[model samples]
Target: MSWLRPQDVVEKALAASTADAQVTYVVESSEANLRWAGNSLTTNGSMRSRQVVVISFVDGGAGMATGTVARTGSPDVAELVAASEQAARDAGPAEDAVPLVAEPPPGAGEWDADAAETSIGVFTDVAPALAEAFGEARGREELLFGYAEHAMATTYLGTSTGLRLRHDQPAGRVELNGKSADMSRSVWAGVGTRDFADVSVADLAGEVARKLAWSRRRVELPAARYETLLPPSAISDLMIYAYWTMEARDADEGRNVYAKAGGGNRVGERLAALPLTLRSDPFAPGLEACPFQVVGGSSGSASVFDNGMATPAVDWISGGVLTNLIRPRAWALNTTAPATAAVDNLLLESPGATATQDEMVAATERGLLLTTLWYIREVDPQTLLLTGLTRDGVFLVEGGEVTGAVNNFRFNESPVDLLGRITEAGRTERTLPREWSDWFTRAAMPTVRVPDFNMSSVSPAS
Candidate 1:
């Protein structure tokens, strides 16, 4: 079906609206899939049978809820409305309760966004290509593994705020893993919705081969500080999570690191030295997302901007300073909320460099080239001191070349500290997968040269 009309039913429910009536409609459909070792492991597809409707009465302080049937089938709108009213009545009067602002009817095409439909064949055909690519490699490894997962969601939302929106999104992931000596080594994770056919198995196999070969030189860099480089994947994860803890509300309550005195939020603070800026453009070619949001404990789509205004581009960071902080619309209206920032998709920007990773290594004079980080944990929220293991590939770079692979190390460092210490950032920013939600984040990061990075402990898992 090109368009599933949940708004029509929502309007029907609204026609019987009373002076105290408040209503919201949300409809969603999703497809989820998983593949492993070039084989299908699980597939799940569902058109949400229950369309969620919530009605609240401000004067009576009563709320109710109900679930609807399938998209084309009869929906129990009345039951949902009654439930909402009952819910509101059940909750005793609250001094803080406010009436919901009524929204007008939506305009044409307000709830539509273009999206490509996907299917099982996407995984079925790509599985063998992945299997064949990894199988062709001749290595001493006992096992080889890989996985790809794709998910698509479509949400339609309408509210009394004269707001209406529909959003469609497709997210996907792919990764390679291999075991040789005695470790469960992992390759890079591919994130984003680039075509499945575009994943080069041969190229992927080569990366696996390099990691397998690095297994031979397992030397440890003794406990101390040294120059280091962080790939995009690690960078993205660090930044995304760091900001999460730095939320204004958390800061306001002394729950976060950047909280300021006198109920003021932190902005225009210089946090890092390495030139970095992050922004979200839903229309950005590779990173567009569904712009609307659902109300808290409510489903479907709310307007993009919190105050019924148009959605604004979000800047998580700019020139190494805290520029934008995400705040809810209500908060924005009452207070100077830093823009309400979610763990939104991040894009890294850097200038074209004069040299390559090889040249950077050659220029390093002496340093550690870290391929990936793992088992990350937070030690201090205030300082952002994070602990994690160096895994799969850790190499020692000397006089512009990888001298040898090094043993894994337990290290503690802050993203702010690391970015500040960067002496040389490669000209090219590479898009890499993040550790959390490995499927969605595409970190535009470059090889950074940092001096005096602390490598705290040694580990056998090289």
Candidate 2:
């Protein structure tokens, strides 16, 4: 029915399924965006959508099999369920199959609530501030370009095992780019927030202005290993990539970087000397996410059978030691490890790291400050080697201060290996990863100082 709510959609899908087991979920999302270029607003709009996912299980002899079908907007409930069941019968036994999650854990989310939503009104306070920033940029003979977006997705999950769980996740990001009138010098600043309330347009504009001012005197530096300071946004991109590779099965099978030299994963080995802790929490203040598992397809890090499973606080790396990896229940049964679902939000911090990025800059005798990392690609799975390019703003720090902007360079390094060489981690702050923001946006990280960061080559990219 056109009038069906998101919760009704989930309930209808579950009721229509005739398989041995079933799990149904509906994600109702609302998004609002603001885009600007050349110091002028280009467009602003809002949209709403609904997505339905139905997973059906069948017992056709050897073992249980599962199949999933996902559809955008309001789908025909009975037909979708039938499709899922038929898909299950057409496939072979699922290796990751297990009994569905029957009970809710401590933070399984609400059972009855309206779907959270967002509208263009979320940017009510931001528009005027952005206009002011535009005026300031115009007077400075600079151009501003960027986008701001906020979205709220409410998930309604239901299972045949008698569980109904829901979670509302709000994700927002604002990126501001400033360039000189000639477009030769450019810099970027971005922030991540659950709501626009915490984002400060003036502060972001000031940061961009300062970077652009520093770029007035440009210098060329050859590709070489140098002391580097990676800001929180840049660090988040690297750390998030590392976090995505934390699969128990891959490491245990000697397939990835976390694998030990012998035959097992490095679950307890010290990976760094600086006592860094990389963790995820479903309820991390401004970065809160879904408290329970919600997946339409099964993979190395997630399983369709694990729906409604609670995602608690997990310390992937604690005090420089590898603590745990994502282990679904099906894989946990084989490894003798507890099922640890992955949370959507991640944070990396070190105790007593009170220095800000400016403070770290003041302490540096000579180094490079990276604003963003883009075009990242994996080079080697064995050692987690990654290659990417520095973009927008690359500043030269000399004698405990930022002297001027430098040339962009291609970089080669691995987050796992780089962890060991970290000399300092500035205070953790919520920031947006420019490369991975499309997929992973909720992250808090610290500006990290590396003694000898590898700059593979000077890039011609302006």
Candidate 3:
């Protein structure tokens, strides 16, 4: 749907509303997805939907209701609005009431024509090449599996507060999992990008083949502390955990890693010893994200009392010191502190000379090279300790060379601790963390070398 139609529908909904009511209409339209397994395409489809959410404040009580309709179908905007207003009147008074305010949205010229106007033909044209790549790998006696997807979505958000926002996002991903014929070794390699032209099927296949070849011979290593070399993929996952733990309210409440020993939060504490910096910027090249975040909704669901809060470039960590934290609107109002939205994209900067992953490995005298991490779960929020398994590929490096592949091991570490012990920092690149790629796709990470990394135990699964 064009911008004009959604805007018109929103205007109509607002005009039909009574006093003390606010409404937001969000319309999303996109073409997406091609799933493949066992080296063959299995399913493909597209979707377009629009949802109208109403928030009503009657006599200090708040109520919210949402109605959705397919873009191809007729919708009853008036009926939906009435139902929401009635729900509000039936509800009780809210515990915390914060006034809703409108903020300026992105400029009209901010839309990317290439992203907004992407054609389904792009996927159709690429599927054949990907399939052929899979076939070629399978013929060489390797088991290959994964999925490819292309999506272009335009989100239109309009509120009664005179806030009108529109953003068009284009995303593509190619994930491949390859294993040896005997199932003794495996590796994961993929690409995530906003442009279809950047995904090279041949290069993806080659990467898997090369890793699988490296794992042809395996070595057994007992669980022990080793000097570890973490690639960008591994770094991305750890950084994601750090991002989620940046809640200011939780820290101030003394339930988070950022909490201080006595009273208050650790905003200015030196959490790491290295010259590390972490920040989020929606306008960052190759890692753009939505400029606004929706806040104050019901737990685990989109809130009827939602606010399209503008997100600013946040300097979360700088010069090894805790610089900032995420501040929700309600919490900010209660504490009289500044409000900022959590970021969808994360960027980690390494000071001084930047080395490539291969260069980092070459400089390592003895260490473990971790390709990816999986099943990550938080063990302790106070120390930011986490437990997870090294996956895809684990190699033993000796005398500045990868001697042989090693058994996978479970690890216990924290991103904060890792940063504090960083001996060297290497080149940074846009990476897709295996855990949060579905939601947080834009990340710029660097290869890092740590002096002592805890490898807890050997894992049976390869």
Candidate 4:
């Protein structure tokens, strides 16, 4: 693939723009992937791509208007700039318009550095470990299927206001599924990582093996409320959904669950009975993300006018109480609140939580254990009701032991409401959300127990 320095491209675009104000962003990315099925490696490859976007701001006498144009790979700086300016000229004034961010963050000094890259070598450790695990699975007449992916992206942001910044981000994930010889039973295990070094194929394989063994006996039970233990992966899925809807404007307008009865958002209201805290930090260890805003559009939670704005750590929910919401500079100005940029990573934790998932399972007398959740969709906006089906594996725990696997069930619950019902929360750890993996994968969560988790109906899914 043809290559151009992302930082240089950002500067060229900024210089080419004729609008009153302009912001240019370039993302140079590299990726590597490995897939295995039927206890053997099926595919392996690497790829490279770049995203170039130019946002132009114009003041058409009445007010400010913004336009955005994006292209893959190398984009002609002049054409991209002209197209963006034309779009701004054709549009009406924008309500979210604000001054372009001018202050340089800590990483801005590294703007001249080349983009970081990833290659097939990212799987050096993963490949051999997968091979050994596949052999073991084959000897046991089991089938192993899964994929491992790694990516590195360097983002460069430049603005007419004299801000130049760059960030290098690396992300990786691995998922493994084990099925019995006849495909009668299946189980899943997944891990989120910054690199493959910390991942252990043996540990993941062992978890899959144990779950499949528990499925040797099947139990059929009607759908009803039951004490349920949701693992970290499941918890991440629910919490991420809640995080995505944290637009301050939506709640203040009484359009979502965080809205107060009369007016304003529930900034001080407690959503969970336990003193849990849900936060996002760009500098979070092992889950670090870009520390500033880079945008080509405007939304309730963000604005193109605020491109290159510094993103500080924020606690949306602190000590169980709503603490903050995603508020761009424009929205913050409107609401008379401090601007809060949304970070890409999320973490949910509580004080004094130290029990592992196994310990939580061992302490349970009678409850359901969920392996994963899928097909999740929103049912209601006001109450934040979400519906989804359990998949891969669900087990019945009796007398502090897993007795047998149970039938899958469709569940209807609200992440907001579910928080208030949490009876126990285990230690926080990195996890992979099976449902939202395609869009969101950076999360750290804990296993949680709900005494009466609602199983809306019995699902025939296998």
Off by over 4 Å in 3: 1-4, 38-43, 61-75, 90-96, 106-119, 296-306
> Per-residue lDDT of 83-124 in model 3, one digit per residue for the tens?
666766666665334555576745322322222645456676
Q: Per-residue lDDT tens digits of candidate 4, residues 1-462?
A: 245688778888887778999998898999999999999899999999999999999999989998899999887788999999999999999999778787886545387887899999988888899999998898888999999999998898889999888889898999999999999898999998888889999999989988988999999989999999999999899999999999999998999999999999999999999999999999899988889888878988889988888888899999999999898888888889899999999999989999998899999999999999999899999999999999999999998899999999999999999999999999999999889987778899999999999998999998
Query: What number of clashing residue pairs does each candidate have, in the order they appear?
Result: 26, 0, 1, 0
lDDT of each model, Cα atoms only? 0.57, 0.93, 0.74, 0.91
Measured with C-alpha atoms, the lDDT of residue 46 in candidate 1 is 31
- Per-model TM-score, in order, reads 0.79, 0.99, 0.88, 0.98
lDDT of 3 at 333: 71
State residue 178's C-alpha deviation in candidate 1, in Å. 2.5
Task: Order the candidate numbers by lDDT, best to worst.
Answer: 2, 4, 3, 1
How many residue-pair clashes does candidate 1 contain? Answer: 26
**Model 1 Cα lDDT, one tens digit per residue, 1-462:** 123356666665566455254545554444445545422233434333335555555454243222222223454666656666666666555322333444432222355453345566566666566656555542354345656666555555555655555656666666666556355444443434544654565666667666666556656568888888766666666666675565555565554566665656567877667566666655556665545444433211121223122344576678777786656544445555533635335665555555566677777778787766777899987667899887667777767767667777888888766656766777544354545655454445566677887889887764
Q: List the residue pairs that clash in candidate 2.
A: none
Q: Which candidate is the best by lDDT?
A: 2
Better structure of 1 and 3 per TM-score: 3
